[model samples]
Each structure stands twice: as structure tokens, then as C-alpha cells.
Target: MENRLLQILVCPVCKGTLRHDREHQELICPADRLAFPVRDGVPVMLPGEARTLEQAPEQ
Candidate 1:
């Protein structure tokens, strides 16, 4: 993902800053517990299209 674009993109639902998960190609909204998918370098920011985050174990 481009740093410039990521810097300006926020969660559609919560209007919160997003954290990019480059490896998984996702933009995560921790406040909303959602993961927005990035496909072919384009972010899918639609709420209906987002996947709910499954809790990850603490490291």
C-alpha cells in the first residue's frame, strides 16, 4: 500500500485511523474490530465488504 494513501484513509464506520497489515493486504480498524480487505493494491473500504476480525492470541 502507498504510504501517502494510507495516511489519509480512515475507517468508514468509526472514522478512526486505520493500521495497514501489509502481509495480509488489509486495513484494520481496531476501534471497530474490523478488517478491510485490500485487493490488487486497492482498498475495499465498504462496511458490508469488510471481514470481522477473529481474535489473535497474545504473543
Candidate 2:
């Protein structure tokens, strides 16, 4: 993804900043613990489309 696009992208659930996971091609929302998929160069910001993050693994 382009730097310009990443700057304006935010988590739809928490309205928080997203971290780009280049390897996985997803946008990570820390506060909401969701990973929004970026398919075909477009971000899917819908909550239903997001993947739930396991909290225990990071701790």
C-alpha cells in the first residue's frame, strides 16, 4: 500500500490508528484487537469482516 493511503486509514470500530502489517497485508487495530484485511489493495474496514485477535498470546 502507499504511504499516503496508510496515513488516512483508521480502525472503524475504535476510530484509532492502524498499523500496517505488510507481511500479512492487513491493518491492525490494537485497541479493538482486530485485524482488518486488505484485499486486492483495498482495505476492508467492516467490523464483520475483521478477524478477532487473541489477547492472551501477546501477554
Give each model a TM-score. 0.88, 0.86
Candidate 1: residue pairs that collide: none
Local accuracy of candidate 2 as per-residue lDDT tens digits, 1-59:
99999899889988899999887788899998898888899999999988877732221
Model 2 TM-score (2 dp): 0.86
Tens digits of per-residue lDDT, candidate 1, 3-33, equal: 9999999999999999998777889999999
Task: Name the 10 consecutive residues with the lowest summed lDDT in model 2.
Answer: 50-59
How much lDDT does each candidate structure score? 0.89, 0.85
* Most lDDT-accurate candidate: 1
Model 1 misplaced regions, further than 4 Å: 55-59
